[model samples]
Target chain A: MSDVIKLAHGDGGKFTNELIKNLFYRHFRNRKLEEGIDAATFSVNEGRMAFTTDSFVVKPIFFYGGDIGKLAVCGSINDLAVSGAKPLYLSASFIIEEGFPIDKLEAIVRSMGDTCTRAGVNIITGDTKVVEKGSVDGIFINTSGVGIIESNYKMKTIESGDQIIVTGTIGEHGTAIAIQRYDIKVKGNFKSDCNPLNGITENIQDLYPYIKIMKDPTRGGLVTILNELAELAGLGVRLIEEKIPVSREVKAMNEMLGLDPLYMACEGRMVLVVNKLYAEKVLNRIRSLEGCKDANIIGNFDQEASLKVYIENYLGGKRILNTLEGAMLPRIC
Target chain B: MSDVIKLAHGDGGKFTNELIKNLFYRHFRNRKLEEGIDAATFSVNEGRMAFTTDSFVVKPIFFYGGDIGKLAVCGSINDLAVSGAKPLYLSASFIIEEGFPIDKLEAIVRSMGDTCTRAGVNIITGDTKVVEKGSVDGIFINTSGVGIIESNYKMKTIESGDQIIVTGTIGEHGTAIAIQRYDIKVKGNFKSDCNPLNGITENIQDLYPYIKIMKDPTRGGLVTILNELAELAGLGVRLIEEKIPVSREVKAMNEMLGLDPLYMACEGRMVLVVNKLYAEKVLNRIRSLEGCKDANIIGNFDQEASLKVYIENYLGGKRILNTLEGAMLPRIC
Candidate 1:
């Protein structure tokens, strides 16, 4: 009966039932969720859909721009969104360390509910399990979401000559978390660019119609994503070093620490491959959207049938962008 | 580079990418998962679908009947099955402890792959994250599944006069786990009842057409689930104590350990509410199926608008079956 969660709350007995009714159900009240069973049954819109799952083990649980809850919701939502899906339903499962504060858990759950509202999705059903204190760090959340891809926007490829656009200033999320994790004191008004990207994508529906491929540069960041795409499409990408957006503070930290921002994680930004005809139009439309004022057509598919990624330098020299190979950072998402 | 898993394997950089391409791809190769991105895009079979998620942290990872990997797949698949869905695509995420053996991880993933194969589902996409050595136990898996429902069997309630039938002997999953966790020696052929219930349900569909509600007796077990139905339907259930099936070994262990089988988990069994007119027919159909040879009609909804569960004894006495209120067993799933 203490306010803190006990091992019994996850034992699938009465305590678990009460915890669910008092905490999760209190925040995620909805018709499908009201059934309150193992799996939530609901109607799905007919057509193509995207499904994604991500586990958030971001240390400290609470971060500068968002907590693990917000990160979980937005992360999965962004995955579905960039796939041209209208993120709809989500299921959240939590692995909490025993002795975790109930107040903090409630706050995280409330944040998740709020994020779902902002992203136009519902948390239908979920699971919670508690482990011995040392068995887990505070808490880890794994969220899986299902979304209906808008038929008209179920876009396709990264053909040669297509322009590649970086949705906004890169590496803000990676920088914000890095600063906090390392306790580096060099400061500016730095916050994670951790917000839902679906709304912004919806705003540019006219341009979305022209885009070929869309993806959120999350864990491995922009460099890894570009390499993966180029390899998959058997094409080479040519990005201008000066054209990609980076916040002044992040750029300063990158230079000072000898870090590459291209490999840093970004929780909210996206990478798009659109045809040259709509390149400027897409960039202009994204610039008008909030959180995307720094949108730029940073690169292009420079070659066909060549699995390579190259960066054009400020001095007009070219360097190959190799796929990131090892851990520069962990749990940035 | 050693045989043990390193942190870099989950760093979302090069090592992580290679792990996915080599290990997971070799086991769960499927068309839907070939995209290998943040989200897997796929076409949906129209109509209503069931969405469910579960995180498995059953301690001692491997047990008599199945490991956490198998439990993860079957658990989520069963949730969707009980909701009348033909489980389809699954998304898996892992929180691995640093220094865990790569062979063990591979075994777990292989178990997941095999379970999905048995359940007729595909592992379309997944994620991996490695936390520092004590931040997590050896491993924890979270699986989310999307499945299509045979609309005809999509059911509603536990009405008065509905027959309650248990698919098979209960308490095996809980007992198997308890014996392992406590290192008890109860010499007998023991294994967790961890088979996929979807195929069993599908086999009985012709007779299951009369069922009103179906649910897996997982966390709360038979007693808790029966109480939940009574409370939800605002009805009282009456059961013949001797009719409820219990395996001889588990029953003996129950009496020897002062444990109640009614509150024990059964990973592979289901609790069903069916019209009295079809109870015997459905029982016959289920009895003819694998894992349900011991199926029996153990109870019935006896009263409307009265939230109570009562059992009739062999000696003509009666007792109340209260909802499980405390931790009898934890993590049996």
Candidate 2:
């Protein structure tokens, strides 16, 4: 009932009940959640299910394009989507600092609700914990999701000539957060690319057979995932430096900040490894999807056993791309 | 590779990979987890499933009996167990403050792995994030669990004559944490009653037909849960004070601290609402299990339309037991 959160709100008493009933229940209402006392029960068919969890602790709760709420929902949803599963139910747990404004909390909850609705997923069960002032920065959210895996989708084996394609331009999210965190005044529209990728993934369902693996480049961005893929496949990556998609604004901002776009994060983009035979078709299909106008074939797995990732320029100069080493940016989710 | 966790460890790059492979993978080794990339995929039968989540920010990460790792796993397991489900899989996410010692994190992870191994559940997928030093106190853990609901168990409707039973003694957990937090000098083996309740729940499966509902009295303890059940069933609760189970040490600690045992928390206990005809049988069955010697039928739903909870002493003295109000103990979990 207070304007800001109190320690009593997490005491599992009247205040806790009020907060749950008024804010969480009111926003995340569903049949399973309403009937649930301790856990939400639902029926699942005989099939494979995907489960994943992520926590968002970005420095500024509200950012240029999205807030922590949207990021939390999209992060988990994207994980399941990239794993070839249709996102279904999610559990949200929050650790809130005492004295946080009720309005701010409501706004965050509203954002999560809106995103879930847009993504066609439900927040079935959740828990809330409030700590003393200064114990936590402001609020941190952890979302775990369950999704039913499609039977037709299976990760194909990677080969020497497998092509790598990116769904969109890189580094928008990390650049926006970096600018905001450093309080650097920028001119152009520099906002996070934090959108749900389920739409794009579902649209490219027909290409599942030709796709070896798909990953959402979130933290440690494009180059980091490329390194992971190269290591996993026991092969080397050959990137055409000019083929990598980077928006002009993101490129300029990274130049100004002296940060590599390759290591920066992206919230709503996918990196897909496709069979060489269908690589062009997959690129065309992804480019037709909304928000994927810049889709392109960035590189291909080399036939070498080096187990390294590198970029080659037009003049044939090659440079190794290492996995992100130390902390480039903290709390840049 | 340092003595303490660095922001780079959460960067989702080389250091993050090393942390996962060396620490997380080594402890939480399972087929599904080892094969998982973005999400863990598993098969499920055609049945109802239970899902739950909890975040543990308990102060004094290491308590008299257990640490935060054990608490986090047990808290989520108990939630699913009380819902008449067999706990199966869990996802763990951690938010650690920079400068926290690596050995402590490993100890916590080892405790979690040990608990999950004992409870027969798997930590299939997880995420780790490290914030700036002052952003968080030390560490916080969030665990979300999924379990399959047993086909034979169904929640029967509550009636006025239903009986209420507790599986073990109350207030041990809260009392133990209070003593540790406030540094109260007492001459007794004061420790938290933090243990997984699945063992007891599984042992009492034969009595599921007569069980109306089950709840773990974790935060607000027995009285708070009684109030909730009374409100839900639209009936009053008449608790027999002498019939309730309380450990001698817990009683002594509460008396010295001037805290009400009725409002204290218990971690490894269950408050079951059962049919009156089988209440005695349920009590006997629970008493025969491990660590449940104190099981007793403490109260029964009153044959009144008034929705309230009260206690009746042996002398016929009665007092209303309202839901807990305000902050009693912060971060007691």
Candidate 3:
């Protein structure tokens, strides 16, 4: 394939078909994705539940480790997962710019189909619109997902003495995208933490039903999510800076960019607030997963304050962590 | 307000509130919208039906007479309505660029709510993500709409001898956006035909239940839609150019741009192919609607040698109307 895209890719003709078959399907091969229908269909346990929708418009459609198609499917599935729901179906809509290489568009769609298949979700419907050159920048994807949450499992607030856990290393996704954008070279190895968290959520929820809140630290990162949890629960959060996991490469990249690692995005990670007693159990369960081998309890909820997030340094210094005023690494998700 | 946008607009704070109340809420004033909730929920008649999603990334955000927000809501709703469904719930997702004015974002959201209300649909769910500057243009909106189509209404092929009618005018949306892009001036007035068409579809469907196909010519225009219908039904479409209504202003603008009015997009207009015997009644019913005063019978389906779209020129010469290989006006939705 050429380094750049052409308009023939979005034509929905011969080139579009070949592109899907070769690049995207090869990586994201799955049974449901092979159907090649507009949408994937599957059964769900009967219930009325919340359905959410989201779109991915990240620049450089293809990033360091993941592309926009993969992001679209995984990001939407994560939203449903955090809502305490089992993602069932997904609908994708594409607004492709004219002159985008057909091969690229196919690669994106095939990757999307593969990602959804791995998540055990169906892409049941989709619409495609082609815009002329200059009107759009390459391609943008929108996905709407429907999931069923068990009526018994209602998302609740974290109480005092609850533990806060990070699924894995933070700032991988953000650092990866940033490095790609700036063309920065780092000595150490790094990979984007881009993976679906539904299976892990399912395993944990099946074991401990009292998981108070679950959030994927994406756009605003761990700092923003923790603040939201504190504000929602009307409690204070105390985090141990040392306990929170971060790769040396990610930290160095952040420092180089004069950025806060806490504000950087992570796609394959999650923050969970559970009773302190089950904190160890939750951490162990998450660690058993493929991508969450470094899961750890980094903080606990405090009853004294209304809505505050404090990070304790290794030298016994405490600093307040504020909610992100604006996006730190926008469109990282 | 400053021309350059700031981060506070998306903060969900005072500046964001002011932006909503002053700019967006002022233009799109409505009760449900004024609530300022994350989502607006409403009930609909329960049934098994079709659900679709669409996103509008129209450049310049605001065009001739309409904006991206209005198009987002109306586009998805129209898709459902044309599919023989009663438009119901909608979900809107936004990807706002960092530094975008909060006022602009709020204006888009409020317009979406107002447009949904006018179309008799509810905004049930939504999502917001902010990207860093340079990642995306101003703003992009993704809307997923769920609608209930009566079990009795089947969207199948139209039989031979079915009469095809177009509501109001064609090419208005495309012409308006093009003129704005090129800064072209016309003596006669030209307005974007960006009104919602649920009412017109409802009235025409009520009058002629045998309406075989209904589609709003938005991106590919009327010619592409006719070609699709003809190909699907294995028939030919014959159109009379003299009967197809085109505003004088749009004609002049098309001439100036060297664009074909037949291939130009129309946001508010729809093409309906009905049984020949009920064609007049359907035409009368559409003409009685507020925005469909100029509805007329402009074509018919024929069992010809090939599934082609033939247009009868004003001088009585016949020419083949082909599908647009590329978008006429990018992001004109």
Candidate 4:
């Protein structure tokens, strides 16, 4: 056992087996992962299942709030959870650079195991491949998740008179990663907002019938996601700028960095579109949850207007917001 | 729309959406992928299911017989297939280096879509991430497959007295990749035997009752796999070297390069451990197929011997083979 990953670890040989047994299997211990077979087998309930994948190329493997491990688990599971499915199983694959530290790898893997445990999901099967030292920067993780959607828990799409909800404070993840990557001097406990939404997804199922759409705005952030949703629903969205929650620290960082918090990624937050009548109920339920105290009703889409997003300012001025064009931030999630 | 990938392509903005719509959607051409949601939801039958994932980082993206794209598709599908599951759906995640050519990406993607078409599987959902030029090599593909296994079609594991049958010639894939990467001269055509095994898995259900264990010999090749299977099953294996099939070109290349064909990789090959009584019947069935034309009974394990692999040579001499340690080849798959 070397201290750093070597090419032999990915050669589909003895070393690879030991790495899987020691690191991945030790952390994500379960019957399927313990099998160490070519694939994992499990009996899934008959129903519509959500299938999604997200690659974690976050620059610094370890950020303030979470590392790539937690991000990988939460990102993939959230996709399924937000889609109104009970996040069940996940397959993780890692592409590691030669000479990467084994200790760091173990820490990342343990973080993933802890996340999966809290989320009540399993990392059933996985693959590990080590490339030349320079071929990859450090390590990249790709997680794909599968979840069964009970018919009773299916969430529908948004319509006119729907109310929008931002689950928590915005831009924390982007702010955290930026400080780590850019070395920003000022920092006041602004770590990433990365976590599994299974908590909210499970509790909100009580009102699932009234829920329209649920999405976690990760990459292009809240503004861009709202624009996409508006276009898809063929409506205009009006947002109360003040109601959009951005922590004082995150706002200060965003202002100083000349970055829009609306366009900043939040790994663990979800935007919910619910029937206006039940919006308050959904918000109250989410607000009582562990990671969603800041949940609030933002605004609703206008059925009359075209596909556009308008944000009303504190001074009573309204401005049009458009979809993100160029890449704003890379490898933030 | 640009000729080369820009950082914005993975920025989760306008460019990322366009790249996915144009390249992935145009090639995969499926309704689920077209849904363009956070995750794809499909109804699957209730049963024991198989899930597997693999990441492809082969150098020289394109080589004889197949490119990385084809390898990604077949490799993932083959895992489920070898597990005796009907390959159903796959989610592909790509990590492409910035500035990679658009045409090449399109070709690789089209190859993937085409492979899915031939394999009768769909690329339901996928994620695309682009990193800085130096962060990764040309491109890497991570595919996770979900397949449904009926009660009858489920494959079993190896048992002593079970016969070992190889689907086709060995070392062709490793040899083909080597010649392309190392610029080896004086070589006959040595193309990789890369392909999906869904066809065989589906058609072999009738014999599933007798199929003890089936595994695709990829990296670390046949010898290493035999060593693994022997230890896992707690039995001893004896292979007849003269009976094992190897193309003359591959054999010559292995000799010239001081590599063992038994340990050379194969993308589309499988090692089946079946009831010795039905071994011949299964080999004949596989031999009648296109890719499995060279399928043959290579050897069997002895019930009473220790966990070791003994390969009988052309001169009736036998030698013990051990597990693979250091990497003989890196990034070959």
Which candidate ranks first by DockQ, i.e. highest?
2
Tell me the tens digit of each residue's lDDT in model 2 across A28-107.
87777777578888899989999999999987989999999999999999999999999999999999999999999999
DockQ of candidate 2 relative to the true structure: 0.89
List per-prediction Cα lDDT, in the order shown: 0.85, 0.90, 0.74, 0.89
User: How accurate locally is residue B99 in candidate 1, as Cα lDDT from 0 to 100?
Assistant: 94
Measured over all alpha carbons after superposition, the RMSD of each candidate to the real structure, in angstroms, is: 2.0, 1.2, 4.5, 1.4
Q: Measured against the native two-chain assembly using Cα atoms, what DockQ does each of the candidate structures obtain, in the order listed? A: 0.73, 0.89, 0.25, 0.84
lDDT of 2: 0.90
Q: Write the per-residue lDDT of candidate 1 for residues B173-270, one digit (tens) a residue.
A: 98888889889977997789987999887787776569888989988689888888888888999889999999899998878778888888889999
lDDT of 1 by residue, A1-333 (tens): 568989988887778778888988888778887778778877766688889999999976887888899999998899888877788899999999889999999999999989888778899979999887788898999999998877477557667889999889998888788888888887588888888889877777766668888888887789989998887778888899999999888899978777788888888899988989999988888888887888999989977527788888889998887876666677787
Ranking by TM-score, best first? Answer: 2, 4, 1, 3
Could you tell me the lDDT of residue B94 within candidate 4?
92
- Give the Cα error of residue B321 in candidate 3, in Å: 1.6
Ten-residue segment with the worst summed lDDT in candidate 4 chain A?
A150-159
Model 3 achieves a DockQ score of 0.25
In the range A268-325, model 4's lDDT, one tens digit per residue, is: 9999999999899999999999988888898898886578898998999988888777
After superposing candidate 1, which stretches have Cα over 4 Å from the reference? A154-157, A304-307, A317-319, B304-306
Is candidate 1 or 4 superior in DockQ?
Answer: 4
What DockQ score does model 1 reach against the true complex? Answer: 0.73
DockQ winner between 1 and 3, please give it: 1
RMSD of 1: 2.0
